[model samples]
Target: MITQRQILGTGAAVLAATLTVAGCSDSGEQSGGDAGGSASIVVSTFPFGVEEFTQAVLDPFTEATGIEVEIDTGSNADRLSQLSLADGSNGVDVMLISDTYAGMGEEEGLFQPVTAADVPTMDEIAPFAVSEQYSGPAYSYQLNGTMYNTDELTAEEAASWDLYANADYAGRLALPDISVTAGQLMVSGVAASVGSGPYDVDAAFATLGEWAPNILQFYSSTTEMTNLLTQGEIVAGDALNGFATELVAAGEPIAWTAPAQGRYMATNRAMIPVGAENVEGATKFIDFLLGVEAQQASAEIVGDLPVNLGIEFPQEIIDVVGDIAQDPTGAGYETLDPREIVPNRDVWVERFAREVVGG
Candidate 1:
């Protein structure tokens, strides 16, 4: 098993420095020189886990296809803002972004539509991963679930959404704030459990409001929630499955479970921006990312849950998610529609603060 320190410390700083320097190149220009007459494409990606991602996906891709890759990394909002400001001249050939931001970009016409004709691997990934809602396909996904201290709770006890409101655990549980990714999932989960469906914010907020006093905190960051769990300040919290995996691997007595009633997931997609200089190379890179080998490596190294149906997850992942990694949809996980999310995001955030967290 990979230790937390090893996963967090390895080559990340150097990779960040390299990306910072590379990202300074002018808009509409490829940051790296062409390699052996092969196309050079700039890939905009998340800032964290740079080293693992490069090793798992980028370097091997360059080795195989001779397509030089230049990386640009930042938070989703910041990077998407940059791409928008650049108009069609962002010079980013491929964008690895969360589904929400991808949907926003698609609505703004910042990305070009991609199909199986452009990336054959699209046919092999999960159907939800290639939804017509976005121009690109999901390369990876995340499940929202409850994380609990095994010493304090059983898997059966933690699997219910009612755990948050249980008087026995009052003032010893946490829930994500409505601003983060996990927050949205929790809201949708609660909505699905107590109301009509995932988008039933009225039912979700009312239920959460009633349970607010029981919650130790409405945590805004993963670090805060994880620290609370580790210090035994809180026994359990609603969090992304990734947050619990490392802690569980480190023998922290942490365990995560998909809630018995409502389950939702978020995805990260591989998108091609409009005016991408190397469209063919972009398609090729995305194809490689969705391929079985690349998906497996990403799951093992970068800890992303693969979207490719053919991927046989590594033992480390199995140790964490068990059989859910095999078939997420069959296991009762569903992705929330981005169209339902993007437009109402602000209103929901405000209401969540006023009614659920604050009330």
Candidate 2:
């Protein structure tokens, strides 16, 4: 089909055609774009942590059909804006975004609500990603509780997310910036050490206070943390499991602990955008992504677990990618509640901005 520059000015025309073809609720069912008689479909998504998989899974799609595939990837937030701006009324045919981001969009009435019927792999996702309103458990990951230099950690230290700090360990630690669920849980680990424990905000802040004088800089972004770990700029702190894996995989001196404390998990997804007409193609693509083979390929390429249990990866990926890991207490997504940890996301977001990040 058409290239980026060709479609750039056609967003409005595409959206208008979609509106003419179908009707959708703001938070209701969405349609795909005009697959038309064209030889290919253009797909969009936010850039993944690793860029290798951008087109890895698409060739099969092309071979199966004569449809050539075009990929546009960017930050999750930015991708949302682009899709919203393009709509189905615009030329953006399909979108692949994180579930958490989808939840936000779902709230904005951007995506159509969906069920397992829409995408079969919906059943494969861990409960952490599912919600009553939106569709899917597309990609799943756990925010693993890890220690740097696993070689330097003791059996006791390896066992829990409790006070990982010691007088000497102070000032050398790098903690996750408290912005999302992972950051909230990182604070929870410190709470457990200070008697506040997991899901207790009061305790988390107290723990931070204790370490404030000694703790290294509280990271504000994912990239900063990754770079710091890579250059050995900092040794250890509460880190995202994926980043921890990247560091270790790259042979960074850091080692990660699969802590017994409950880890935070995020399941990402994609949904049909409102005010678009590609419903036929968009729905098919969503269904295709949830299939066993596609899920498996996605997990292997991205280093995140497939929500589908049957999708198996090589041993190397399963070992690194975060799946469902129960806490030492054994109460996780199955038995425990998400609200107990985050409660009101708005409140958490606000608190994180002020107290945690000092923003």
Candidate 3:
């Protein structure tokens, strides 16, 4: 029953500051420079509009490693801008980036290269967690799928992405706009289901055209979509796993299922900026995050599927989201390679507006 306003911190602007284990200080040293010399690392994360993530993962890492963790959080665009401005001299020690930025970050030399040897917990993770599309490894995962009110749409009708394009569901649906990853995923999911790859841009555009009439509104955030769902405004449509989990837990009548064609899977990778002062400490912390304890906490607290295979999720999570812990590819979930999608992001956005929204 945790509300979005409760999980997502108050919208007050959080200044980026390096907090030491002892207390908060504003010296702004990239690395820990306190007289005590206790190691500290600066980490920048994309605020998923949630506060529980900090308590579930970041705080525990600091307590266990005795490394002061400096936190900076913002929207995806804001975080990337802050990272691009940093040159490692005053850069973040760890950066949690989405697949959209992973390739660009590597091309810009924003992160240090890591391997299984560098991170012992690497082998315990799913093969996809190593991230073929990005230089950094994935720490958490999500799947894009159709979620709907079971009272209205039977599970059979909601069982596939095809439901979005169904003429019967027109004017009662909600969809993600191009700004969010879920919107991009909607493109890929449609393309694959209709027999097209990332290269076939027209195929995706055409599919969305068919779906446009059914979409009542295009949502820019999970909070907006959840509001629509709670108000009985949106009966069925595509959405991310975590958002759906929140709605279900809050006693909403909504339910989710990956389509038969497959869900579009994504991951958030954590990278150490090239100029990180505490490479060893940062690596250990990354390794710790991939361990069972942190992974379990994330799953239980935020419904973020852990990349680690060793950890078991609670039955409640399983009931709401079946087989989410499995390798997305192995489970027949089609993943849009970030490498392929990143280059064409702008074009896709433009087409989404012109073809889907404006059509």
Candidate 4:
């Protein structure tokens, strides 16, 4: 597990969120810049994140053009703080943040215009991969879901998150770290299940208060959760697919699902600071990310759905790892859309921290 202390690097402070414009006008047809000679760019990403993303997406850029790149990896909090500080400063070239983390950055203007049109593969990526109005989703995943140990529980019992909270299974379940997006969603599902809407704080905390004891620990890191699963510490509730995929791919018996009761579909995005200095480079990287080869490579390495429309993968890539099966009675788990709930993010987070985290 990557700790925030070891991950956050010293950063240069740029513009805080206090910049105000005399007259707010359109960014005036996305700013454009041509590639001059060769240059390097800095990309900040999540800690213990996918280096394979860089290898799959960045390496080819370097190979094609002699430009070099460097990365600063940290926890979700570290990246958010750094991105907030870099809001108007071009000190950081490009930043990749998860869908859960993207909201704050998107609201704070931490991103620049993406030259999506320049990327030939733009049409091939999934529709949700594109940002709503400002930045676009780099790549995304339905990361929030349940993967139960087959030896301990049968497929019938591992179908949804609610099972862990059932009276029969009480005191034997465990949940993922509260700090991440998927974990929050798994916990949030409990709230939304009994509420009027996705953001109902009243419903979320009530559910957590009830489910809390059944959970052994709110793991702070994926590695810890992995160890817990391996050692039989916690049977299951929810987790990110990477850990689950590895086990399932290895033939460890497991059952998985993304409950329709509002499972999270996490997206990584490319944002340009509102007042960035190297806008040209940032946009270029964004386009590079959306290109065909980049999409193919990124999806292959990271094991998530590719957002870029252009990359056509061989059947091997598409069929390599199949998706999780959804439960028919588990809150319409197949078609949950996360964007609709963005407006309630802060409220949801607070509600989870209070009721679910037992704060």
**Highest lDDT among the candidates is held by which one?**
1
lDDT tens readout by residue for model 3, 7-69: 013332532221223223432453554323537666777655346776788788878877767
Alpha carbon lDDT of residue 124, candidate 3? 89
Report the lDDT tens digits of candidate 4 across residue range 1-359. 11112223443222122122221111111121223332555565654434576678777876765455555456555667766775545345567776666666666766655645654455556555565654655554555666666788765566565676777766667676545666666655665677875556577677767778787777766667666776776666676555665565566665455554555545566766655545555566767777767777766676645655444543333332243312212334322334545566667666667667765
Tens digit per residue, CA lDDT, model 1, 204-283 = 99999999999999998888999999999999999998877788889888889889988999999999888687888889
Which stretches of candidate 2 lie above 4 Å from their native place?
A: 1-42, 49-51, 82-93, 123-129, 155-159, 188-200, 250-252, 321-350, 357-359
Candidate 3 structure lDDT:
0.72
lDDT of 2 by residue, 1-359 (tens): 21222122334443333212111221122223343343444566544432345344565555555455455545565667666665433445566665445666655566666577766666665555566645544555545465566555563564454444565666656667666445756665555545544657766765565566555677766566666655665556666566655666666566655556554555556666664455555556666666676667776666655655566664545444334332322334221234353235567666765765463
Q: In order, what lDDT does every prediction score?
A: 0.84, 0.54, 0.72, 0.57
lDDT of 1 at 98: 90
Candidate 2: 10-residue stretch with minimal lDDT: 19-28
Question: At residue 56, what lDDT does model 4 achieve?
Answer: 80
- Candidate 1 clash total? 0
Q: Is candidate 2 or 3 superior in TM-score?
A: 3
- The best candidate by TM-score is 1
In angstroms, the error of model 3 at 271 is 0.8
Instruction: Give the poorly placed runs of model 4, Cα more than 4 Å off.
Output: 1-38, 49-51, 309-353
